[model samples]
Target: MKKDENLKKVAIAAPQLHRHKVKLKIGNWKKHFDFNYVNTIIALALNDFDDKIFFYINGYLITSNNLYLVVQTTEKSAEEMVTKIENQIINLLKTNPQKLKENRSEVSIIADDENLFYAARKPLFKIYPLENDHLIKLITGQKVTLPYFDRDLEHLKNRIRNHPFCSAINYLGGIGPVKVTLFKDQIDPEI
Candidate 1:
């Protein structure tokens, strides 16, 4: 089956996990705390899913749906942060065994602004293996260019129509400059 098809099955067949939504106010220097907290919460909530939680930080919509859980943080002490994150992850593993057996893939992390200072501070840098090498090469191989919003719209439409999995999306009721949309299908429309 196609990747999208398999993911759709996983979404539909996998047991729905309890989700926690946290809104935290932090000073600029403490921004790192936000990533750490979010990761910890996801890890705790989905402990059975092989203790794997995908993270995304200010991620843009893209065709490749494989790397959905990618995040960037501002913590400087990588060694310490990785240990803590891993410990929380272990706690999740001990809590959920069945889900772990079903989903053992690594979590994806997408950094929102490519902030070098923040990137350097992430604990994942010190612990989890990085898998963005190919993506980095693909990006570096291309000539840097400005984004075309119109072109992106077309690409998004094509992806939504041709994706192999069915998707259910939820979005803010009204239209505005910024909107929030949730996807429960193979391809998230509002990603």
Candidate 2:
């Protein structure tokens, strides 16, 4: 086999996870997201890729009929990745005999970025392991406004900074996540 001139392997320092905002909508407003099925599909899909696909999984939300996930992963064509995961979810829902009565999910990819910041009550971060050693503590601010919060208009950004990346995101609803700077050593210099 000939060596590929375009490819160069880099060691891991910190995983520069891009934020992918995905909303999985059940056709019927009365139905809930098939949690087990969603997990199963994503797990199965990730199994096929040896590269680290996810970095920080901020968490997910279940509105009346939709499941919203805020995921951070290495930037390897995030839209394509989400589409692949969604297709797998659709197949899983269609194949399950028990789920035949339900309609398939409408998975939508909202945004992809490495600089997205998210804030919630200090008491409610139960699902994501924010303290994981692999995750670098970028910023921690208080009182930022997000629809995800109980109130409106008056929100605080914990340790927030203004970065061009903050404005480039097209799908964070109206609420913005805090922006943090990465150290020179964090990103691969050659990349």
Candidate 3:
């Protein structure tokens, strides 16, 4: 086999995890949350990718519908995917089929492999193991009074800062588990 042909084969055989996080936020609703409309929007966004991508969607109900989505496609850059999705969402909103003229939505790329690396380096929060003394105090019902309380709190804070990585992620939402593929090493051992 020719050297160039061999290289092409190797590249084709390798797994490509081109993961991207897209956040979709819809705002300005006077009445109820329209779950159907949001669902339709998500479906429409994914339609462009067809079967070329693997994706997970997590929806948050705040003042508006906040969707955090992770899409992995072997063939396209994150930017291309985001642009397509943004255009689809904007066009749909412009139609205003629901007659909610005031309603507006925004779609953005939150992270790709590169920036997610930097984000992983930062600690969301840290956990410190409870000391034997603290456990004993809690078990014995020590008086919850000033100096001891203040000292314990300060001590706990110090431990967390000193050993930030001792803590692992407590929860993994929809994107959390699958999106970890973008940075496998960032996954904490404890989790």
Candidate 4:
């Protein structure tokens, strides 16, 4: 089989599949762009876990990750697209058992926007762990605190940055967004 064909097959077989929708109020162009760039980086990194990504944008559902990526700019700006993608990726990493080992994972979103003679960029990164006391507190509606680890955060940032897919997205000037929520189970009304 051809290399591209083989990759296609592998992509189809990967796990971590889910669908998501999001809407955001837009204000500043640069801020929005930075947000989107980070979102894209996170999405690219999630592909490292071999998940089949799907996104719903302006009522349109995109299936193929690659195609979804290509069309990300149609409904939203380049930055917005990146942010959505990263949010999805972080959601996946937080939920997928196979990907979540020792209760920790990290993802980074980088935004690169350049003017005629000047360039500016920023990275938004997130770190998740099984022992995320803050997250637990939020979910459980309780108060809790845990020691923060700078080295661990750095390690996670490096892992996502060095990911093969993330590298490509960054090169394309995409930035990821910081995720506020992770995995959620569907509520069944019939229950």
Q: Which candidate has the top score in lDDT?
A: 3
* lDDT-better candidate, 1 vs 2: 2
TM-score of 4: 0.20
Clash list (residue pairs), candidate 2: 117-177, 141-158, 141-159, 142-158, 143-155, 143-156, 144-155, 144-156, 145-155
Per-candidate TM equals 0.24, 0.33, 0.32, 0.20
Candidates 3 and 4: which is better by lDDT?
Answer: 3
lDDT over C-alpha atoms for residue 170 of model 1: 12
> Candidate 1 lDDT, tens digit per residue, 1-191?
77776664334454333221111221232232334343333335322222243321222112221212222233343343344444554344334322111123443232332342342232322233334332221211211233655575454445533432212111212221111123323242222
- Clashing residue pairs found in predicted model 3: none
Candidate 3 structure quality by residue, lDDT tens digits, 65-172: 443344455535555655555556555444443433223473333223233223322121122222234322221222223543577655644542342121112122
lDDT of candidate 4 over 1-191, digit per residue (tens): 77776664434453332322222222222232334343443444434422223432211111112211222123234454456544554453334312111113543332221230121122232211123323222222222333765665554444444444322223224432211222234232211
lDDT of 2 by residue, 47-107 (tens): 3443444544343333333433445567555455456555544444344422321247554
For each candidate in the order shown, give its overall lDDT on alpha carbons. Answer: 0.30, 0.35, 0.36, 0.31
Best TM-score goes to which candidate? 2
RMSD of each: 19.1, 16.0, 15.9, 19.8
Whole-structure CA lDDT of model 1: 0.30
The lDDT ranking, best first, is 3, 2, 4, 1
Which 10-residue window in model 4 sums to the lowest lDDT? Answer: 58-67
Pairwise lDDT winner, candidates 2 and 3: 3
